[model samples]
Target: MARGAIPPLPVWAGEALDLITDMPSAEDLVTAMATQAEGALIRAGRR
Candidate 1:
């Protein structure tokens, strides 16, 4: 941070900054979630 109030940063936060600043890919998200099906464990914890 410019203010010096905060210690610089951890390695993972720097890496996450790059990832969060970039645009997310919808198709990639869908592909990644393909294994999860509708009505499958949607609310298992509450049940």
Candidate 2:
């Protein structure tokens, strides 16, 4: 988040917490979720 990277969500879905001090768009959150999975895969050498 500090580096502008999206962190992964918790196992259970809940209300969104705006940590950026600003509201995030639906698409932005979706992209963050996707990027999180991709980042994990990359760490496992899958990407």
Candidate 3:
């Protein structure tokens, strides 16, 4: 693949991707999940 290009997803993964009709793109979902995980960790550290 060219620089910065994402490699092709596997067949099962491609099918799973199609099921996500209303969700944000995978990259956006990953970022949002990372943010939430970080917030949870910070909160736990304060306990």
User: Lowest summed-lDDT stretch of 10 residues in model 3?
Assistant: 4-13
lDDT head-to-head 1 vs 2, winner = 2
Pick by TM-score: 2 or 3, better one:
3
Could you tell me how far off, in angstroms, the CA of residue 38 lies in candidate 3 after the best superposition? 0.2
Q: Which residue ranges in model 1 land beyond 4 Å of their true spot?
A: 1-9, 24-47
Q: Candidate 2, after superposition: displacement of residue 17 in Å?
A: 15
For candidate 3, what is the lDDT?
0.82
Q: What does candidate 1's lDDT look like per residue over 1-47, in tens digits? A: 46747665786698888897795688877866764643355645522
Error of 3 at 6 (Å): 37
Clashes of each: 0, 0, 0
Give the per-residue lDDT digits (tens) of candidate 2, residues 1-47: 47966666761233344454467788999999999999999999999
Expressed as tens digits, the lDDT of each residue in 1-47 for candidate 3 is: 58977767796588787888767888998999999999998999952
Candidate order by TM-score, highest to lowest?
A: 3, 2, 1
Instruction: Give the C-alpha lDDT of model 2.
Output: 0.74
Model 2 lDDT-worst window of ten: 11-20
What TM value does model 1 have?
0.29
Rank order (by lDDT, best first): 3, 2, 1
